[model samples]
Target: MKNVSTREPGLHKGVLYAMLAAALFGASTPFAKVFVGQVAPVSLAGVLYLGSGVGLLACFLVRALVQRGQVGQPVALTKPDLPWLAGAIAAGGVAGPVLLMVGLSMMPASSASLLLNMEGVLTAMLAWFVCKENFDRRIFIGMLLIVAAGALLSWEQVPVLGVPWGAFAILGACLCWAIDNNLTRKVSASDPLQIAMVKGLVAGIVNIAIALAFGYALPGAGTALAAGAVGFCGYGLSLVMFVLALRHLGTARTGAYFSAAPFVGAAISLIMLAEAPGATFWIAAALMGGGIWLHLTESHGHEHEHEAMEHLHAHSHDGHHQHEHDFEWDGSEPHAHPHQHVPQRHAHPHYPDIHHRHRH
Candidate 1:
């Protein structure tokens, strides 16, 4: 029996990336709320996406120039990846932001930010049921707590409408994002910058075009620029980190770490919007905090199989990568290349990372 019991090398990096992505995304919610009334929802969404697209495009260009002809460069997207990328863009890029903007217009930023936690629960559900990712009681219980918190956060005493339509819209946004998260996982092995950049540009352009056709007036230059800057950090960089996390953490776990985003958003909302938290907010916060803790503490280890396969991604000479290179390669620690995996079996702590997607 192989006795190589160690934590997956990517675990810490994945967690950090996931949390940073959460912080950027969470902070974006309140900032977006700042523009709620100044610009039309659809138009604001368009501006934000456009900003991310434009910003990332510049970054992509610079990185390409700097890394020109680098041998170990990240793999580019291929034909088969297009469908997954397109689906992710449509769900997350086009629909998610629009719904979030509309919801922000109707509710407090803090409340809207907290409500976005529903995305984690939804993402986990899809990962477990549809994508067949493994899970345990801890994950299930954590998801339940998050779901309960979302319900409590959204609940209102309105006689005619039990819940505010704003809550529904935000929840709808969460669903779209959940779908996007899963779809993006299908192409997580590609260059994350390219993936994020394409998503930003396509989604941004489509949203802006739709908004213009629908007669929504564009915001002033200052407002547009502000929205764009927010998008670059919140949407563009955050998404790049998110895709990186997905490669190491898988969809559900990444979503769990990313769930912390709402807390960051809620805190920013309080400071920026001067919103006072009521008992509901505190209770929901506690519940969400507990749920995140559960996920963070999770660990899984067992003898799992790795089937023979061929793919490309950035990796170092870890246990999973024991193949010989055919080229006279400079000995770089982490590099990307087309490689093949020989079937193997062993036991160690693991996530549903790129190389460890066997059915449990």
Candidate 2:
């Protein structure tokens, strides 16, 4: 029997990654809202994602130069990873942002940001039922709380932009991203930066083409640059961190933690725009915060069996890792290489991590 003992380390680390991704992406919402005045909605979406793609591509180029002869490139994406990446770009990059930008154009940033929690609920549901990711009842309860919070955000006395159309647009955006989240999981083992960059590039190009077809004039360079900067942090860096969390936490859990993003955006929007949050906002915040706490503190422990598995990612010689090398190992504690997990049964706390996906 093998054990990846001390579940706190992995759980805490994955939570940290998810929160950071949330913060980055959430903060981008209000900022993107502000930029809506500077360009067409679709154009702004394109630029933001374009910036993310270009910035990450540059980082990857530098990384390659620095590790030209490295024995392992943990951040490299292969051909097998492309299909998932394409779907993520199409759903998340292209459709999601266009809907979000259009929604932001009509709704208050605070309201829009709060409504964005829908993505987590949708993502979790898809992961739990559709993807067949193993999870317990607690996750479902947390999902309900998040869904309730999202519903609260959609309450408007009078729906502008065509009778609650804005709120509906944001919900549509959430669905697109939910699909993207599931698709991205298929390639989560690959380099996250590479996946994000490709998604950004393809999505940016598609959205930009659509916007140009609509006859939106190019915005000033300053506006374009600012949107790009937002994209680099909110989309590029956030996605890289998100993929890291996904590798450790699985799709549903990762989305649950990422529910924190909209809160960050709401706080920033209130401060930046001097808008007030009403009763519904505070109520929704409490529900979401509670749900996020539940996911964060969760620890799944059971005597689960590990089927013989072979894959590669960043790792150390934890108890669960008991593989001999085909080549001379560099004798490092933590390294990335092809290793196999012999069948084992042990009782320990775990998540549905890359190694721990077993029947519950």
Candidate 3:
């Protein structure tokens, strides 16, 4: 049997991360829209991602310098983490955007925007079915509503499935991102900055290189800077928060929480543009609000058993981790190291967070 516990402090932190990620990403939407015609789509995407990498790398460098000579700091990204990180970067960074640009060229803007909404849906599906993230009916309904809000915001009578190759390409982008999301979770326990920085740099470089190979010229300096700024927020910071959320909330729940991004983006666009929103906008807003509330209010609990397990990630001396050390031991909290879990059984409220991933 599997038990769900919502009483953990980690889930609260996860919700905060998820919402913050949504806000940053949502706000970046309109900013990125400003760069659409000013630069080639693929080339601009590369710049944005490059900006994210550079910005985060700079932050990481500064932090390391400040912490210079500090011992016992957590080392990030073990040899085992490489394969997962590489796959995430390749799928989400390189292939996803490239496919999106291809699809956009073939389809109408309205259709493309609508199709982009599928990313959330696909993310949830992959989290639920493939990754075995747990969710009850309320959570599922919340996801559906948030996804609906996205559809409403992008709605333009774009036929749901009438498009051919173009639609397939767009859908491919969604799947790639979904896969990337799941794979990233496999390494979420690592330092988020390291994971995000590496992903941004590799993906950005690969994309830029491919674009240059095809003779895509770089945009003007001002436009490039703008794209990079947007990328820093939308892609870079958002990913950092998202990884943190995964560490707390698992995959499917995080995906559902992220589905509220479109609504946030739409609201921000309306404010920035000083344009009046239609009834549909208000309706979508209400629905999304309700959905987020459902998620926030959820309480999942059951009796479950923990099989003995062992792994490495950042952690503190919580109830779940009460083991001793082999070599020297320090009192520093939330540090990373290899650890083991002995078999135990308990009953409580929970989410399918990293520690509670028992089969139902």
Candidate 4:
């Protein structure tokens, strides 16, 4: 097995990246909501996604050019990887943002913020089932609590008419993201930047086309600038961070940490939109906070094991023989010592004077 310590520093890095990504993602909702009021949802969504896609693509292109004359060739995209890439674009790039923008337009920022929590539950379930990852009873219970909290937080805000479609669209967005997470995992061995760029470019084109077809009206100068900024921070930077997180944290943990985004968004909405949250919102936030704590704490066991291993060493010596043993002999005087050996485990204190028989 790969050493956990070696993996842990990266995981810590991933956690930091994931948290920042969640914060950026959360901030985007309020900003997007601001634009949704002034511009057609589809048009704004199109520009946001397209701009993010183009930004990522440009970064990828620049990197590729820089590395063209390097030792190893630039990472190549294979035919087999296309389907996964396509799926990520369709779900994360195209559908998720489009639905999110539309939903924000129709729903109150607070309600929409709460509804966004469903993404984590959906993502965790899909990753657990489809990706065949480990999901213990605790994780399952935590997920249920999160779902329950979401329902409670948004219960009163659920619309009575034309709401089902919007709800369905939002749910579909979650599913798309779930699919995107798993698909991205399948191709995680490649350079994350390259994968992100491809998904962004392809999905951006498709979303823009769809937006235009749906008769989305273009926004004015200020709205356009705001939308672009939101897209760059939320879509572009967030994705890059997410991809990096996935490298160490894997989909399940990544989803768990990302569950905070909605709550963060809700807070942002409350501040920026001057929206007042009810008692239920506070309760839900507490539950979500507990969930995050549990998720982060669960990794302590792994860290403990790693720490223990780093400080200990094992060696072999013969108690029966006075001198170094070369070979095994049956109860004979002046018996030959059959074997002499020393072994060292890295990242542990060495015992120079101690020698003992190898234990089975």
Candidate 5:
């Protein structure tokens, strides 16, 4: 049996990576907004996604070449894995970005920024339902407050957009991302770089085809360069970091950490573009902060148990192999016990002793 230990340093590294990804994602919003004026939504979406795909592919190819000996190795992708990959491409890579682009084109930056917060709420809910992740009542309530705060912050802009169909597009994006979050959890056992590359390539090609069919004009040199840079940062590097973090943090915690991106974007908009959100925006920000506090500070103290068994390999009196069993307890309270080993068809003990410990 293998002994598992809590590695605080690894958790810290995961948090740092997650936070950096969130920061990059947030900073990309303003840049994406800038390109909306110079290029059509569909075309912009295509260029951004495709560029991101190309960038990640390049990085992945280099890594693969460096580790060429490991190439063509058999991967255990069962029938269950395909649906998850498909769902991830559809939600996170395809639908989410398309909706976000369309909505940004039709609405105020501030409003769209707040609406993007919906991704967090949607993601958390999906993680809870689909992944059966543990979430206490306080976490749910905090999530609710965060959503309400976002609504409050963007309330004024809602009237300005005035029931535009494009707003629905943004909601679609959130739904796609929610689906993507759940799907990511399913495929997280795979290599993170490989997963990112596959998602980027598949989604990029599909988005580009859609963009071309929509009659969006190709942008000139300057806009193209800017869009490409934004794509690299927002989609490429950001996604790599996100996948790496997901491996350690899981979906729900990743979503909660990502919830800070919009606020970071909002701050960038204010500083770089001089776009100021009104009083309600600040109030919403406060609510989100409180929600974040609740999320980070609270912990559910649940006990987990692991079973370990030690057996002696010897011929048994029951015409089978016989063994002695030893049990060890490793948890908040320490105790030891011993049990008899019974051999059926196999020589090993049927039941093993379990060790219990708390996870951070």
Candidate 6:
């Protein structure tokens, strides 16, 4: 077996990225809620995602111009990444936001924001069970608490004959996003900005076409501009950070960190919309907070073996990447190029990051 030495960076950076992603996305909820009455749900969703796409496209172009001839550059997306990207756009970009806008129209912004927590729970479940990502009792317990909190949010004191369509719609949105998260993870090692931009553009265009076909009229320029701004910051920038977090933290942990988004949105909803929630909301918040705390404090490490592998991503000459370059002598610390990993064995603390996805 080839030797495998490694430089283990702390996960604090990933934690920070996840938190920032949460903040941006969370804050978008109340803003979106404000637009419900002014614009049709599907049309509003299209505007938000379109704004994300257009804004990121401009940023991506500027970065490309500035980074020309730079020694270290992120890898571009490959053709193989298309299917995953398409799935993500379809599920998250198109379906998720449309469902959310519809649900937001039917419920209080605060309640809808809290209901969005179900995305984290669903994401973790799919990551652990379907994607074969590793998890422990602590993670499981945290998921349970989050699920319970969602149940409380969906609970109704007065029985209604029909189903709680609003809550169900939000839950549907969560499931779509959960699927998108896993699909996006497959391409996380690629250029995150490009991935997000592409997703936003495709989703935006498709949804806009959908809205137009449904005879929905576009909102005024002012409302459109506001929605776009929210989309650029919340959906576009937030997704870029989220992809980076997935690169370092894996799906479940990143989803767990992102769970804080609901609280952020709920707080904003209370302040912006001045909607006071009842005792159930507070109790649900406490339970969800406890669950998030459990995930935040989790640590995992062990002795593990690495089989030979080959791929590309940004990297430095750390312990994990001690190989010869076939070309160039600039000697950049972190550059992207195709390289191979020789089979080796080692022990260390790690997340199920791109490289650390070995058998548990």
Model 1 lDDT, residue 125, Cα: 86
Q: Give me the overall lDDT of model 6.
A: 0.84
Query: How big is the RMSD of model 4?
Result: 13.0
lDDT for every model? Answer: 0.85, 0.81, 0.86, 0.63, 0.65, 0.84
Candidate 2 — which pairs collide?
none
Per-prediction TM-score, please? 0.89, 0.88, 0.94, 0.71, 0.72, 0.88
lDDT of residue 237 for candidate 6: 99
Which portions of model 1 show Cα errors greater than 4 Å?
A: 5-11, 97-117, 146-172, 273-282
Q: Candidate 1's residue-wise lDDT over 248-331, tens digit each?
A: 889998888787676677677778768898898889888888887787778888988888999988888778888999888899
Runs of candidate 4 exceeding 4 Å displacement: 1-11, 61-76, 97-115, 145-165, 273-281, 300-360
lDDT of 4 by residue, 126-243 (tens): 7777665655677666666655655565566655435566666677777788888877866654556667667666776777788778777677777777787788788778887887
Where does model 6 exceed 4 Å of error? Answer: 1-11, 98-116, 146-171, 273-289
Where does candidate 5 have its weakest 10-residue lDDT segment? Answer: 349-358
Question: Under the 3 Å rule for N, CA and C atoms, how many clashes does model 6 have?
Answer: 0
Give candidates' CA RMSD values in order. 3.0, 3.0, 2.3, 13.0, 10.2, 3.2
Ranking by lDDT: 3, 1, 6, 2, 5, 4
Name the TM-score of candidate 6: 0.88
Higher-scoring candidate on TM-score, 1 or 3: 3
Cα error, candidate 1, residue 225 (Å): 0.9
Taking the tens digit of each residue's C-alpha lDDT, what string does model 3 give over 1-360?
Answer: 334344755448899999999989998988888888877888988998999998889989998898786644546898999999989998999999999989988888888888888988898898888878888899999988888888899987846555588999999999999999999999998889889899888888988998899899888888888888889999899999999999888888888888888888888989999999999999999888988889999988777788899998877777678799886766877777789998877788777878988889
When summed lDDT is taken over every stretch of 10 residues in candidate 1, the lowest stretch is 154-163
Compose the digit string of candidate 5's lDDT tens values, residues 1-360.
222233343235555666777888888988898877787777777777777777777877787677565423323334566788888988888778878877877877667766766888888887777656667688777777766775674455444667777678787788889889778766654555567667767876787788778776788878877787788788778877786667656677677767667667767888996776778668878887887677656544332433344322111133221233344323321111223434222122111011111121
Best by lDDT: 3
Off by over 4 Å in 2: 1-6, 9-11, 98-116, 150-172, 274-281
| Overall local distance difference test of candidate 4 | 0.63
